[model samples]
Target: MQWITIFKKEILEDWRNYKWIWVPLVFIVICIMDPISTYYLPQILESVGGMPEGTVLEPPEVVPSQAIMMSLTELSMLGVLVIVAISMSVIAGERKSGVAELILVKPVSYFTYISAKWAEKLLLVFTSYLIGMLASWYYVDLLFGQITAGQFFSLFFFYLIWLIFVISLTIFYNTIVKVPGLVLTLTVVTIMAMSAINQIFSYRMPWFPNSISGHITKMLMENSVPNALWGAVSITIILSVGLLIASNFILKTKEMAD
Candidate 1:
């Protein structure tokens, strides 16, 4: 109940402070950009002498499921960037402004405060992904045809896993770095490192959340049930809990320099 109250307060604070604007804008842009690019790309290429003589450039045949997955991947990456930016500021901003001390003085424990913030951010990310998926559906329907519920849900679920992984990375960075800029830089570097490592070693490692999501998306698009779905789920669940535990531990031991 106390955590719920804290979570509610955090949501209200986000609304009041205009933190809700970025998610919608970022996701909407992703939704609109995907179909527009997929629809007019060949035409744009043709206009630019992209089709050479004797080389017929046929329009790329995009399956509805593939298009949805593609759009979801693009939007989800953007969501990762946005979430990292938001999470970088989550703790460091409060600490810089002396708000951390004020909040700590309240009845809230450090664990509650950290957990509430993460929960709020995760909810916001999920909402953003949902809006982006809906927008993609509308655009795809207008351009192509209606997609199946299975297709939509599968793609959405894949992206949701990606989002959770990104959020976990962000929270991990937030706990380690006290400056927003440093946290953001570290988060990006961490993401890149993970991607590189995953490329080098294509296993279902717990550290490679983004890659796991991509594999899941590929599985859905190819209409193949991933053999490692259970493994990925287990990784996600374990990593999420691990991140929450680490964040709480750091918050509990952190000293207020103010």
Candidate 2:
């Protein structure tokens, strides 16, 4: 009951902040632009007339699947930044403003508090991403060709896992770091480090969380899941759960100290 109460409160807070509207709009706009831009790139480039006098501009032959994948590539970069920026303050902001302390003084457990916030954020990110991807799929289909349901859903599934993993990491940092800027820095740096490590040692570390992105790409291009897909997914889910548990543990410890 208290978790529901907290959940409803978070929903109201997000609504008041216009996050519910603008976050999805930002995602949809970013995704839709990818397909449209790709489709019209040749025409747009020629119209600008910036090429040398003898340069012949040829239109690119982009398939629907490639177009959709390109949209997701942009989504993974820009969309992940949007996700991190929006969720950077989930717990840190509350702690900074003293709202977290006030809430904990009431009849609520820290686990309940953290779980509610985590659930709200996960839902928001997932929904925003799904809508954005679907919109991109539609445009890619209209412009290039039809992308099969299997291809679209496969991309959505793994990418969704990657997004959830990032959300968990952000919330974990939010709990320990009271400064949102530092929290953002730490989360971004950790993600970049993981990606770099995965890139450097992909063969040895196929099970790493960051490897999920590689598997997603492999699945899209080859139309099949990599042998490491399950391993990467399993590790990512475990790490995400571990981060949330650690977040709850850190919050509990902080509460004990106070």
Candidate 3:
């Protein structure tokens, strides 16, 4: 209940401050861009004549579900950037603006404060992702055809997991770093580096969570359950909890370094 109050207050402030403008814009871009690419990418590619004079390029078959899912996942980089930006303000911004002192003067514990921020950010990210997914679904279906329930849900599940992982990484970065720019830069670099590392060593380190979401998405596209999905879920949970703990600890130990 207390955490909810904090979350509500922060959400209200977020709305008032329009701290969410980029989120929807990014989502809309992802939703629209995906279908456009799906519909035109093959033609665009084939227009570039690169073979024998008599050679012909076959148009790629467009599967509504697969195309939509691909678009959603492909634009995931935008989603990750938005998540990091939103969460960068979670703790670091408060400290910068002296809002942390005002909040701490209240009856809120550090845990409640951090928890509320995480909850609010998670809700915002999930809401944005859902909106993007639904819009992508409609556009793809309108252009192509109907998508199956299982396919829809499966793709949505994969998106949700990927979004959660992104949010967790952002929160972890926010908690550990004091500067927003540094936090955002470091987070992006770390995620990219970890992803590359995981890819290069995936055969030897199959349990690496960084690449787990991509593997899951691939499996979902093939309509098969990948064993790595569970590992991804577990790592996400662990990272989220660990970051929450670290944030609370930092808040408790550090004064408002204004």
**Candidate 1 wrong stretches, greater than 4 Å:** 45-57, 203-208, 222-224
Candidate 1, backbone clash total: 0
lDDT of 1 by residue, 1-258 (tens): 878998898788778977787677778788668776887787778788856677766667876666666676676567577888877888777877788888777887777877888889889878877887788887787776667667677767755776776777777777776788988898888888877887777664644565666666667667765756556656776887788789889877778664
List ranges where model 3 is wrong by over 4 Å. Answer: 19-22, 41-58, 144-146
Cα-based lDDT for every prediction: 0.74, 0.85, 0.73
User: Residue pairs in steric clash, candidate 1?
Assistant: none
The global Cα lDDT (0 to 1) of model 3 is: 0.73
Q: All candidates' TM-scores?
A: 0.87, 0.94, 0.85
| Candidates ranked by lDDT | 2, 1, 3
* TM-score of model number 1: 0.87
Error of 1 at 154 (Å): 2.4
Backbone collisions counted per model: 0, 0, 0
Tens-digit lDDT string for candidate 3 (90-158): 787777777777877888788887778888888887777777777787778887778766777777775
**Residue-level error in angstroms, candidate 2, position 257:** 9.3
